[model samples]
Target: MDTVETLGKYEIKRTLGRGAMGVVYEGWDPSIQRHVAIKTVPLTDVDDPETQEQIARFRREAQAAGRLTHENIVPVYDYGETANVAYIVMEYVEGPTLDSLMKNQERFGLPEILRIMKDLLAGLEFSHERGVVHRDIKPANLMLTSNDRAKSRVKIADFGIARIESSSMTQAGTMIGTPTYMSPEQFMAETVDSRTDIYSSGVLLYQLLTGERPYEGGLSAIMHKVLHTEPLWPSQLSVTSPPALDAVVKKAMAKRPNERFATAAAFSEALIAAASASAAVVSPPPEDATIIESRRPVAGPVAQPVSVPVATPPKRSMTPILAGVVVVLLAGAGGAFFLLRPSADVPRPTPSPTVTTPAPIPAPAPAPVAKPEPVPPATVAPVPVVPRNEAVAPAAKPAVSPAMISDMFAQITATQRCAFIGGSVGNNSEAVLTGIAGPGARDDIRQTIASHAVPGTMQWNVANADTVFCPALTLLQSIAPPFGSADPVLALTLADNRTTLHDGDHIRPRLTMPNFVGYLRVDYIAHDGTVQHLYPQVADSSGAVADKVHEFVPGQKVSLGDPSAGQPGWEVAPPFGTDMIIAVASSRPLFTRPRSTNVETAATYLRDLDAAVHAVRDGGGTLVGNALLVDALAK
Candidate 1:
């Protein structure tokens, strides 16, 4: 098949990608001075009004996804239809889908997956909030844009199968979703909600946490397990996998929507907690802990998105052949008619690790492992510290600031795509370090939280989520509305979601891997054997640092890293004081009126994440929208 010469003004560059819905193209927008992605759906093997309607749904998908504009959510630039083809114009993101990551790595480490989950959650939250349900939240739909890109670009893609959960899903009756990742209710073709997406997300995460699917079998067998069987706990899949992750997978794959998280943000928060716990134990590794996480920095060529034209999508084909409809879920029912079978024919679960592994295995959390041992390796550089005048030490800054906490909340909510705020709660096991813990240990918890915050990173580590109940209560009384409304998505109460481990059970959630020697710009330690530090050439991409600002005035012209004002050693005092980290918002809605691919489609949405950041900073602890809305995108 030869490539098409053109689509409208876009000169077809090449076929960038393809999916079940349509083909994507890399095209040149000669007049626009930039590259654009064109998605077009062509009429394929079909006949009759029924088939036409199915194609119509594809066109409608273009209409739906084109309206959204969040960073994590793909952006639709334009839409139109030819007599035989329909197309859409969009921003080409740069990276492979989370599916590629999982495929490449078998299972992603907890930290990387957590980061990916946050991005996906933010995009989903935005869509869900805007009356859309992705309907298919599999890894294939979630793209991983480089955080290092000039645009800090990250996005979720492929919303062709989305349906308006509030109404459309019922009539659509579309049998959508990958079997291994499909929520239990999806197989039944039952009424679904945001919870359905949650279930799928859990399944995908389970696969990411463990190299294997929770219940692996052929298509027919997997469907049977999805419909009527439970899954093995994540810990059971890999002894190195934290048991804490088990709850997350279970919650995400819960049979009932009510049993799952109410929003993508909630699930993300749970994931963050798991990561934090894992990090804590890894930092100062527990004795005899098995190696977990990677020691080397991540490496891969960033996948750049090529824009394609929007085309009329095929109508929703509500009926698809489900080959395994009655293989397992109804197996026992069939046996009732032949009740003469002996009791010995039935299978009884025995209590061996192998036997237990086949079912809902109770994977006990490992002794805190997966964290790298503290090393004098040149890759993990020492953190910089700021010296302060003892006279002003008490006034230097508060251990925790309301604004700092608020900023963290905003950034995490945006980036992690959770409506929840993450900080350490003041709680710890006073048992004086019984055995070991994972990355989620209190110490590693402090370090990871420390990674993002400077002076006042609030923490809920070494403590239950209730430890931060004071702030939770404050947020309830002062923040926004609908905290306890019918949606209940933003209920003020924070869910601990941590594994309820017995004493002596080494538990943590930090992901420690070796660094990459490729580039040494930044460093973090890991526990994985033979892990190395990885860094890219930042010297060329970034400008040389300017002189540090001596004053704290807003928009001051001073550059970062001022000469250690009075003393040269001041910068190395300690990592805790005067360190600054950038925070970007990452949260999005979990529900939407119509499912879509555009990142901006959520009920409460941000068309531009970069813009949202400045608005948030300017608002100074106030809502970033309203009068703050500018005329940039409107033009």
Candidate 2:
């Protein structure tokens, strides 16, 4: 790899990091006399369709972040291209990612965790309000910077996977998030809202308190646990944990989106309350009783509504009335007795005592000694024994033959099996399936497969796909036609009518656009994730002069005249796989600038293209395009 000293106005000091998308460098922006982190991916790598889409998405989110003015979010300052390399310049903060910090520290103290959660949720609330969803909010993407006055500040980084609420950039049914941090809905590949972030924040909080992730396993196992298993209470794992915190965790991680906190603000509020209650007698609420949610049936029969019986107040007792009457009579009798007794109480009597002594003792012990008899010889009859009843054993179920089990599995419908590909049963009835495609009732699928494989001996394992997979977008996302008319179509042809090409092979891309005269920009994403502006590079490599934006007329054909003509023709390069060539045409000028040395400089150009396409549908102007997929060298 060649080390470059400069990219646009910035001096690349050294490489900071590199990933599948591109490389990040510590750079010095000479114009501003400030340090910056510059990220760039070479044009040669962007040629592959996957790489193109990925890099494009990365730039798109950078542009989105550039629009935000939040202190908690990593800021995007500038975007440009130089020497066929696209670069995004961002604020260079000196800090370690939370992931790195967590490695050295076990569980964060309550104060530390509270501060982090508050700052994190604040960033999330700001981003969510602005309609930007940071689909990936893992610990690694959070930067913790220390300030002189404040303990630490959390900055959310890496908006490469973020999506604007209004933009449908992500195709439907695509799963785009880290599975461990993903919400149940995300795992199901269902539509996600900001509550998805709440669930992730809950997982993050859980980890901070317990020093372990809520779910840990292989991809499929993780997915299963995230979807179904409730995390162990933090108090159970960490002795220092406050019991009151469990309610907050339960609310944030409620399996259903509606069950989770309504907003990041709400989640933050709960955390603050729990932290403040550290000293009080906090019998906050029963976990289930806190929210008082209406009861819903869960894997049980629906209970019929019952009318509560009303009770009448008890009648006053009559025993007290009878007791009062008896007391009055007794009192009257005592008064009469007292009046009669006074007259005869004057006389009393006296008595005397006498004493006497007499008696002789006689001895007669010998007579009774011989009367003892031998009456112990009588035998008692044994009681008839009664037998005890024993429990009856249940009959054994008939064993299912291996052939019958195989046929049962064969009978499962493709839909019932969902995206399971090929399957086979081993001698011991261990069934292995090639892969599972989308999310579905995995438990049911396993049961169905087992029923047909070897009922009792059956075991299931996923082969190709270890986790649920989302379908890739194959069709070009293009502008719809105006006024119900057919969209302007563009087609590409290889000189040899072959989709695969080798290095040093020159191929002419024949062009078509919306049949009307309009501005056209022809671009190709190379396999290395580089964006190549093919046409109108006649006089300079940066781009064409202002007037050369192509205009299309019906039945007008465009082509690369010969291999010798460098402009509008592509010579295949190395490190090739799949590449996509797209032609965008709109009635308005798409590029605000005349030249883009690389794709980062072209982001605004692409963004304007998308806006134009959308604008045309709303009766503003016309925009349309077509895409061609070509295979370059395998490696």
Candidate 3:
């Protein structure tokens, strides 16, 4: 090997680090006036088929990572090749890799651990949605950057073995990943997906929580454990670990892919939920119960008792009629005893004191009584009891009249290009108007709506549009008025209950059909000018069902894009701005013909949707729709 000074336009300054296959150098890009990291792999023998394949893979790294645009992902700036070497130029991230930190015995608090996982999952969600699966997800590839607020920001690097879903570069049955973090399926040489990354992330999380990897040993040992054994729960290893966190790790590292979280978003949500649960104080067991003490096993031969609580039955009072019957029977028995006084004298001789343990008394069954009249149902439904330490859904806000909100929204749409007003309206009116607009337009829209509606009802979630989203603003304005009202028959909300999101954020849309029973369809209108079908992913396969309608019953809540359900959630990506998710419930199928593709131009989708809405209306079929606007910003 010879000393190299440069590769293409990147001036190689000095060596930064060395890997198995290549050396990374801190380089300077003159044209961009910025620092870059140059990774160069030597071409020892170009004619060798193996070398040629390696070159292809090296280029594929650039292609796979280059397609992704996210704050948590280290972006590829350029790719070039010399006669004897090939190189990739990427953003120069100045920070320590998570692997290095861990090796140095650096400790991570719960907040820091969560932040790292959030950023890592966010990056994976973005890349996975774009059809790239990072086969190798390890601490070595995660770099930590400090933000202006001195918070750690994670950036994922080294997509060398990342497999693009649409590409056939990597063949199936090729075992290519770190054995320590490889998922069970990966070890079996099976096809991998986003869940593979999830498993690896779980391993990283386990390490973070317990200061040790779930499986540690030689290759064969790790493989056997990952395939057939379950690691000790996080709580078992670390006393400070919460039981909820143990559940999260177990599910994330489930042997089967289907058992794991369906999407990175769901995994992230579970982590947040676990944190919340761990923070909550656990309630004590009820009184009138016998409880045995048990303790979690530690690394010793000490024996501990298993804890089990037994409930005591409540005592019941005898009814007046039953008590009178018992009294009459006792009086009859006393009279018989008086008649047989000789029998009592014979028993007195055998009355020697004998001590014995009394048999345990069994609880008596209640005597049946005459049936009483049925009671009418209560006006308000009784709240169902939730077990201690379990999550409780927030109570739904009081319903508001849609007509008032609709009229107020109509006034705001007269001028603003990217404006959407949603929420409820009434004495307890609460609405949020979100979109991309300038300061003047936002103020004007807010002021106009605030005057007509309640002063505090309107919440403005507006942001200035960047160059990428400027054109989308015009398109949004041209679209027809959103269907349904502030109070919709089918309600939709983000699973995390957040309206403001950032790059790599997961979008889990939850739908509730409280008072409606019909087929449902959900479409995501993105800031990138594309409308993607989010529900009933495809038409009926056998054509047995004409409408391909997915039926939704009243009082049922559906979490769309949940990976645990074998569906991927929508992940926020580039062209950050405002986006809308439209949900429609119809008595019949809205579109009889199957769509050629799930995604189409916004104009085409709206045109089709408008026709469908009108057709349903003309046919006198029940139809309802609702829209939720979210602001997607750069992290």
Query: What TM-score would each prediction reach against the true structure?
Result: 0.44, 0.45, 0.45
Distance from true location, Cα of 581 in model 3, Å: 69
lDDT of 3 by residue, 391-489 (tens): 332222223244444333443442343332222234534444433343355556555444333223544444344333333333222222231232224
lDDT of 1: 0.39
Error of model 2, residue 159, in angstroms = 0.5
Q: Clash number for model 3?
A: 3
lDDT for 112 (candidate 2) = 75
Give the Cα error of residue 431 in candidate 3, in Å.
66
Superposition error at 555 for model 1 (Å): 83
Comparing 1 and 3 by TM-score, which wins? 3
| lDDT pick, better of 2 and 3 | 3
Task: List, residue by residue over 327-358, the lDDT tens digit for candidate 2.
Answer: 00000000000000111221221111110111
Q: Rate the local accuracy (lDDT) of all candidates.
A: 0.39, 0.51, 0.57
